[model samples]
Target: MSEKTGQCLCGAVKLTARNVPSTFNICYCDMCKRWAGGRFMGLHVAKDDLNVTGGDSVTEAVTSDWAKRAFCNTCGSSLWYEVTDGPYVGGRSICVGLLDDTSDLTLGTEYYTDRKTRAYDFPEGRKQLTEAEVLALFAPTDAEEGEPE
Candidate 1:
């Protein structure tokens, strides 16, 4: 694990992630493809391990019941995708493209693999999880389900 720093394209939003993993993951979900204009590749970091500067230029939109996506409002650079509520709450996946040095990083997982378009293809033998698998892995726990009113 190492520290990584980066900024938005226009430099309006900057961030530093501590203890970041050397592996990153990709998401091919429809929303991710539309948001990133392709597969969304990200480095998972704990919320507390990520420090942001120029946060005023950042904006987040809740994209799903459990997750939200952030970007630089000024330059429209996708910043990170965060799990807002669920077992993975407090986890944020920073856009790998936003990192300053990613030479050491490698592909870890490919999510929503079934949704990937035929226009592109990654080399075979990579770890992949389909939408159902992803959903099962992150499904809300009993505690998160809340008691019936």
Candidate 2:
């Protein structure tokens, strides 16, 4: 893990992340594609590992019941996608394109593989997960419903 710094296009939103990972993931879910104007390349990091400046210029939109997406209000640059509920609450996925140095980063996973369009395709041989698989892995199970009476 290493420290990294980046900012939005207009420099209205700056961020410094510590203990950053060496790999990033891509999301091809419909919302991600629409929000990013394509696939969303993100680095999953704990909220505690990230620090943001120019927060006044950042705007967050609750896109779903469990997640919120943030962007630079001044420049409209996508900032980060954050989980707000369930097992992954407080987790943040920072936009990979915002990183100052990406030379050492590698593709970790491609999520929502089933939602990926044919218009674009990454190289083969990388790990991929469909929407169902992702939900199954991360979605919280009902405690009582799963337990035997």
Candidate 3:
């Protein structure tokens, strides 16, 4: 796909991303829900492919042993979820809602499905991964590479 542009709610932070796909993943983990107020629909992108302006306004908090969360310090709009180590190093999961245009993007997968709260449920048939399944898919691969899981 072509490059896309977007900005935070207050426009204090703007970004341009190249080579973005037409799909995004949804995370139903508790941390995701707490951070984003619901499922976090993130557009997966390579870190280098995403360029930002007003970067000084972006602040990050290490949310886990393997990744950190970034947001606009001015408006608190989520920017992206970054991997600190492992095969996915230099990769980021950009917040889909931050995109200026979202007409082309589709739901790719849902992670932490088993942990999804009872308050919300999605339609059946989408690709789904439970917490255990997600760990099994990523942990060993990164562990073998000597990166923190």
Candidate 4:
């Protein structure tokens, strides 16, 4: 993996996810839709791998009983997330807009199919999985501590 760095729009918060995330997700969950104003493309970084720096101006909201969403208060840029207790563990699902080369990354999975809007539709045959189905993506995998195996 390469060193990829991203900063909030107002520069009040900076972060580094040292390696490519073990997985990714494109979420259509209502919570995500409400937080993202439509849909959310998230890059998953393990709790240990997400470094929150210059966070003096970062603000967080408890979007749900088990999750917290963080954003840069200075520029209103949704930064990352904290899954208090869920199938995802503690991964920080950083906003895809914060990434530098998001185009190079492959779309992994689109989640929350049950709640997706009927106003829009996924084209072709992209896999769409419900919440329980997508949770399977976070299943334990064989990998070295600091590297993808």
Q: Which runs of model 4 end up more than 4 angstroms from their true locations? A: 118-149
Order of quality (lDDT): 1, 2, 3, 4
- RMSD in Å for all candidates: 18.3, 18.7, 17.9, 16.1
Q: Write the per-residue lDDT of candidate 1 for residues 1-149, one digit (tens) a residue.
A: 99999999999898999999989999999999989889999999999999999989999999999899999999999999999887888889999999999999999999999998876578789799999999999998887899564
Top lDDT hit? 1
Worst 10 residues of 3 by lDDT: 135-144
Q: What overall lDDT, based on C-alpha atoms, would model 2 receive against the true structure?
A: 0.91
**TM-score of each candidate?**
0.80, 0.80, 0.79, 0.73
For model 3, state the Cα shift of residue 137 in Å: 47
**Clashing pairs counted in every model:** 0, 0, 0, 0
Write candidate 4's Cα lDDT for 26-110 as tens digits: 8888888878777888888777877778878888899888999988888888887679886987688888788766656777899
Task: List lDDT for all candidates, in order.
Answer: 0.93, 0.91, 0.89, 0.79
Give the Å shift of residue 91 in candidate 3: 1.1
Q: Which of the predicted structures, 3 or 4, would earn the higher TM-score when compared with the native? A: 3
List the candidate numbers ranked by TM-score, top first.
1, 2, 3, 4
Cα-lDDT of candidate 4: 0.79
User: Model 2 residue 89 lDDT?
Assistant: 85
Q: Write the per-residue lDDT of candidate 3 for residues 5-24, one digit (tens) a residue.
A: 99989999999999999889
Q: Between candidates 1 and 3, name the one with more favorable TM-score.
A: 1
